[model samples]
Target: MRAIVLGGSFAGLLAARVLHDFADEVTILEPDNEQEHRTRSGAPHRDQLHALLAMGHDQLERFLPGLTEELVDAGAHLGHGEQVQFYIDGKRRPTVPGIRMIGASRALIEAHVRRRVLALPRVQVLPHRATGVRTHAGRVYAITSVTPGGDCHELPADFAVDAMGRSSRLGRWLEAAGWPAPRIERLRIELGYATARFHRGHELPDTVVAHSTPGPASNYLPSVCEPGALTAVEGARWDVVLAGYTGYRPTSDPAAFVNRMRRCVAPIQQVADLCAMEAEPTTFHVRDSRRRHFRELPRLPGGLAVLGDALASVNPVYGQGLTLATLQASALHRHLRCGASPHLPATGYFRRAGAVVDAAWQLSTTADLAQPHVTGPYPFGYPLVRWAADRVTQASILDAEINAAFSDVLHMRQHPRVLTRPRVLLRTARTLATHKITRPT
Candidate 1:
């Protein structure tokens, strides 16, 4: 069997790696030649800080043994959960001591994973842009591509997988081919972000500090890394995103950037003061979250599947994309091992993948909606739930158990069900009561 995967990204590569077990030939078609190194124009935030959740680490280790070591060898930082401090709503929860995570640039992670995938004898990566897909006799027949020399070619395959990022054209192609369009749900979030790197030895006190605005205030989330490097990401709602949103943008004027940091909460200001700007500030647009309900489509072409951002993309702020992609790949592997029907594999994979997306989506959307500037259809009972969540945040400050529970969900180790456990609710109530009693009248 032969398999062709579109988009040579984290998801595409992982899918190809798994397909190697079942397919005689597996080819990855990437549109960009520049991906040979630790830089990708396709992923604008490639240089930004990315932390692999514990669950992601587990999946990588399972799929590719020594993968974590490979990343560490490539200058990635390994830290205990407590090493990274998170301050929410002006309260710093007592850190959970032993959880471990890998922190590195998105490029570094991609580069290392690509190297591993390419080393497999059955896998080949062809640098070319995928223009469209063609099906014949109830099977995906070819992936259309344009070569660098301005020529067109068709690469035939027994199976085709789309792992292209957010701007995938597969949906339109499917429609043009007379297939029903995939169901899509989009959330409009007016989000803007600017990022810059700085020398790491600066006088920063914490490894990570996330300052969140409970209402309309702009917020900053900065990360400290190895090699004497640090990255600061400042964000705001779409309407006020320019100058008024975060009160600052990534500017060549270092003094101005630092001055804006002063407006953030305390620790962020302290970290901002210690470093010299090392890179140019780049700005990008962040719309809302989007998901293509491929599984819901009544008829999908046999031997065709979509994975990664092409299938669904969540808000990047949650740092869940890579982790979820890894989980999806693992799910694909499991589905193949079961010897399910060809059409059933694609449908079953999407059904299972939705559960993973739902966990991350709820966490990210609810948080985004908390911003006063963000507007959307609030589901019935959302306001009451939001109020309860705010109380949980308040309680997390004093209750170590509550903090741990929240962290587990944030890290993707536990499902959202953990949040609704009766013990958590009881503890949250007691903590809130204690906090109120301690306040001076």
Candidate 2:
């Protein structure tokens, strides 16, 4: 069997790797030829700081054995427990033991994954722009491709994947081909962030990751403290990013970026004070979070699947995109492993993938709704949900046990509904009551 994957970045690479277990041959379609740790024209946010949530880290390791060791040996930091820090409204949360995360740039992590995936004998990367898929009797059989000079060709395949990030043309193609396009849901966030690299040596020697964002103290507004994150990435550099909503977004100005960092938490402030700026900051804007609901479609072409941003592009500030893609790929593998046919509509696969998307979407969109600038398409019973969620979050900062449960949900290892369990709610209430009683009036 032959499989074709569109886009060769993290999502497509993982899709190709998974397809290798089911198909005899797999080809990745990507136009950019750059093979280094740099952003490609196709992916504007490739160079930004990306987090591999604990579950994403586990999925990556499972897909590519020894990747953690490979990345660590190449200067990427592997942080566990206290080395990974989380702060809300400038106050650091007590560390939870056994929690692990890898500090690395999106580019570095993708480069390594690309190398490992391409090394598979059954897989190969192609320099071609995919136009659309060719369908016959409701099944995809070939993909139309165009060369650099506008020459068109076709590649036959038994299966195809659309990993074409946010700007994917699959929806249009489906409509043009007479199939009902999947319903799309969007939430306008108007989020913007800037990232810059600084030379690293002995600074924050024991730390690998530090992240700070708005909380109840600030009413989830950037006015109280700058929301940003810093990661100890490869090449002995500290990758710092500052984020804001709507009009308060960070800019590319070097001095202004550092000034914003100074308003952040202690770790980011330390980077601003001690580390010399390596270069001008780069900025990216996200106007909205979008998701394509393929499972809702009445009909879909067989032998077709979509992953990554093509399926769901949530708020990047939440750092859920990469992890969501990894989880989707795992879902795809399970669907195929069950002897599901590539020649028929992948109903089972879409069902499983949709469940994964639901989890990440709920987590990100719920938090994004907390921002003052964000308007509603609020979920059902949002007021009550928000109150309960806020209470749990406040308690998590004080108790390690509660934090672990919260972290499990944040990391995508467990469902958000788990927080609603009696045990968790009971602990949250007790913790909050104890803090309330002990505090000075």
Candidate with top TM-score is 2
- CA lDDT of every candidate: 0.68, 0.90
Q: Which stretches of candidate 2 lie over 4 Å from their true place?
A: 437-441
lDDT of 2: 0.90
lDDT of 2 by residue, 141-165 (tens): 9999987778898999899999999
- Candidate topping lDDT: 2
Q: Model 1 scores what on Cα lDDT?
A: 0.68
